[model samples]
Target: MKDIEVNELKERLDNNEEFVFIDVREEYEYEDDNLGAWNIPLAQLPYKLKELESHIDEEIVIHCRTGARSGNAKQFLENKGFKKVRNVLGGIVAYRNLEEEE
Candidate 1:
């Protein structure tokens, strides 16, 4: 269970890196702000696991409002045998802070 800083995640996004990026926040939270990640909503992750089956062995990055939810999501995915699961440190809050810093 590796953790990725928001800076590295932003660089990857800028470079068009290919990976499974998931936002585990609820729909309303996502609608307010997001990184264009696939919205899986932590509560519904179990039901949507199949949708992510193909990416089980790939790099999967998960984030939430403040990283707590995404941390749980990362643990859950790893427990389910996902080979590479990374949680964005500080989640979107840090991500936005990075944006503001620039």
Candidate 2:
């Protein structure tokens, strides 16, 4: 999976570029905080693959609580032939810190 820095993702969003940001954390974790990503818990990803079919050719960024789950999700999507997939290197925690710094 490609590694994307949180700052880069933030800049993309700020520029109004459209891309799919996926949060692979649990419902509670997602509710607590997210980078405005589409919430799809990792456990349900396989069954919900169809939901993201439209994004198969687009840039898709997957992230979880820390990054492990997102890595797995990235691999899954790659295996399934999703061309452009990225895993945020440090997840929301890192993004939050970067935001504060900026």
TM-scores across all candidates?
0.97, 0.93
Runs with alpha carbons beyond 4 Å of true place in candidate 2: none
Off by over 4 Å in 1: none
lDDT of 1 by residue, 31-92 (tens): 99989999999999999888888999999999998899999999998889897999999999
TM-score (C-alpha) between model 1 and the true structure: 0.97
lDDT of 1 at 14: 100
lDDT of 2 by residue, 1-102 (tens): 468988998899789888888999999999898778999999999998898888899999999877889999999999999989999988888888889998
Question: Which candidate gets the maximum TM-score versus the true structure?
Answer: 1
Q: Mind sharing the TM-score for model 2?
A: 0.93
Candidate 2 C-alpha error for residue 38, in Å: 0.5
